[model samples]
Target: MADDGLDPRRWAALALLCAANFMVILDSQIVLLALPSIERDLGFSGGGAQWVLSAYLLGFGGLMLLGGRTADLVGRRRTFLAGTTLFLVSSLLCGFAWTGGVLVGARVAQGISAALMAPSALSVVTAMFAEGTERNKALAIWSSVGGFGATAALLVGGTLTDALGWPWVFFLNVPVAMVLLALGPVLLSESRGRARAYDPVGALTVTLAVSAAVYGVVRAPETGWTSASTLGALGVAVVAGAVFVRVETRSAAPLVPLQIFRSRRLTGGNLVMLLTAVGAFGTSLAVSQYAQGVLGYSPLEFGLATAVLPVMAVVGSYAAQAMIGRVDVRPVAMTGMAFMAAGCLALGQVSENSGYVTGLLPGLFLFGLGLGSSAVAAAVAALSGATERDSGLASGLNTAAFQLGGALGVAVASTVAVSRAGAVPGFRAAFDTSAGIALAGVAIAGLLLARPRRRRVPEPVGVTMSKEESTCGT
Candidate 1:
């Protein structure tokens, strides 16, 4: 570390970490475009086809907290490399899968790998840069890269699936993972927490709780929300969650320290991320359905047309980063949410006869801008107040919130889109509901985050600040 408390190779390390972040996010969205090809090739029966996506999500969301805590206990670099190696093997398995069952299993493995990689990579970044302007810039780049990854998936997935085959979608990760594995040890430093005790009971209960909750929400659209299976899964989640909390409270070395929630900024930041994801994912689903189903655009064409969203998002992220250096996060976050609400409202005005240039582009542009800005602000706010020891745990909680929100968004939007009389009307209703959600986020941000009366200079490493002081200025 330098006198400034930043790593000497922080930029190079950031590039590598951002690449990993991009790959993980890419896999999440890329598979959506290739689902039909996967279903046909593997001879999927009934709704088993959806499992390709759901399996990944369940494993990723379920094991996320454990993955984060593991990083703090074991080692960040080792955990990241282990995850990357597993991801490489799983990608190959997915490419060569001969049956639907085999493919779904491989996808679950991929998700598990991602759960390990995501938080460890983020924790490494947080550890590398001191919390201030430097950290804000780094996170802005990370957030923009993530936004680019999702849209790039749409573009790349369509092109690869059409030109080569759906298998290439899986094959694409092989080289990237190989490169990360090669450079990781050379570029990254190894670090672990002082507390070395493992909490198996807490881990098991929390994992089960999150997995059950994710499964319940992911399946609710297919099976009626009121069905026995849905209720049962949710009940399991509730029970498991209670058990985990009890275990953590008693454990000498808990998986997640209950006191971490005492930071108002951390809690508020996570909630903002959750609500932002709810609107972002729900709107994406609604727009994709409208463009492909209603507007009659091929997958490739659709991808090409909507590319503006991510482009504008990249622009917005950098702009937000500059703004955050001067002002606090609360205004930036609220402004971003306001933009998102306006975008959704614009999308809700689309009709059957509307054109892309006039009806869709404007809404997408606004939404993408908001996505980039809000994501960076939320991330900075959430991690800014965390002590170095709890960084991994905080990163995990933030990620889990986003993933869970995504599952909820897709399910609720799918249900809302089909509830109306016609396709266009149903899509419009979903967009309108998404707008409402974004507006609610604005209110929550205002209520939860405090405005700092004055800016504070960055403190040196190992310097402790009061909880109230730490919550004020991120």
Candidate 2:
């Protein structure tokens, strides 16, 4: 790589940060693909097993802004170390878990830790690298690794489940987390957002509100929406949500500036991601189950099957890197999102009796291709206009949006599946419905993402102040 005003130390630091982020995303789906085996071994019923996946999404998504805000307030490097420590400890406990409850609890712990890691990781990269190529290169690599982790999770999880048992999937994080944690203190420089002061109330209320809402969504399929449990959760969500807004409006140091919504680009990218993720993550889980249960694939077979995603996404990520300099993200993202919708739509047509070779493989390939390219493009689009100070919060918000979308997708799909009464047909109908949802994301990505008449650079602007403490511009 050319100097581009970037130091080798900066790239080295970003590599470690990307590794940590990859560890978090990879574990999320890998566990899902490995779930059936884990459930059988632990003697957990199907619904009980859902918590293992749902809990992680809930925790990670809920506290994401808090994590980012803390990074800005405390110091990005400190937050990264703290998050990594918790993630490592939680991973160990998860591996040692003897009961379903224990595993689910540990997964939530891991997610909370990940919330801390997520924002710190990206924000640090932005601080280290100057805006333009140096920054874009680092972010491209970071986002690419994220896509790679998600795709590779299923395959690696499947293999671990087959060869080493499900415990190894959790245990797998131990080495990676340790390595990243060790590298961080040595390789990373200490830095915090230039903004002074902090908002504990803003962070706390928003975290509680989002968690409550996602919890309601995740649990709704198991508890009928009309039931007291569901109704109570919804009520909690409403109150928390309202309180969160009120606090932010009044807080001296707001967790997130409500004005970010003013950017049509940011909102459009977020909505597209929300829908795309709902389909992609939901499909990843649903298909993993279908392959093992319906197709009678062993864990090893299942892992190998999902290898397609990582491979295709890596290719797509690289392609996006090349195009980022030449093309507006709008066209690239829209194209990828369209492909994703088409891929899902194709998958929806698969018959119950269809074979992997004849029916599932084709759609999987296209879906994987779309997921790989669009994810990178969409991420860049979402965070494009952000300053280095708020990059962490931006990344955190993007992550939470995706996870929340997935959680909702899982709940909706599970509800549709359950209401369909049986597993196979239920899976089919739910997946088909998800496909339609994904297509809607395609249209949004296409119609809403702003375009420039020519290859253009983002408008130069001052870095926004964090916590409303002080003014900042880059």
Best by TM-score: 1
All candidates: CA RMSD (Å): 2.7, 4.0
Q: Which stretches in model 1 have alpha-carbon errors above 4 Å?
A: 1-5, 452-474
- Where in model 2 is the C-alpha error above 4 Å? 1-5, 40-46, 421-424, 452-474
The alpha-carbon deviation from the true structure for residue 447 of candidate 2, after best TM-score superposition, in angstroms, is 4.3
TM-score of each: 0.95, 0.90
lDDT of 2 by residue, 147-251 (tens): 778767878887787788889989889998889877888898777766757777777778878888888888888887677887887788788778878887786
Clashing pairs in 1: none
Quick one: how many clashes does candidate 2 have? 3
Best by lDDT: 1
* Local distance difference test values of all predictions, in order: 0.86, 0.76
The 10-residue segment of model 2 with minimum total lDDT is 465-474
lDDT of 1 by residue, 1-474 (tens): 777666798899999999999998788768877989999989998878888888888988999999999998899899999999999999999999999999999999999999999999998988888888999999999989987886677778888999999999999999999999999999999986666699999999999999999999988989879999899999999999999999989998899887677666777888988888888778887888899899998889988988998898798789889998888788888888888889999999999899988999999999889888888888888888767787788888888877787778888899999899999999999999999998888887787666534445554333222343443443
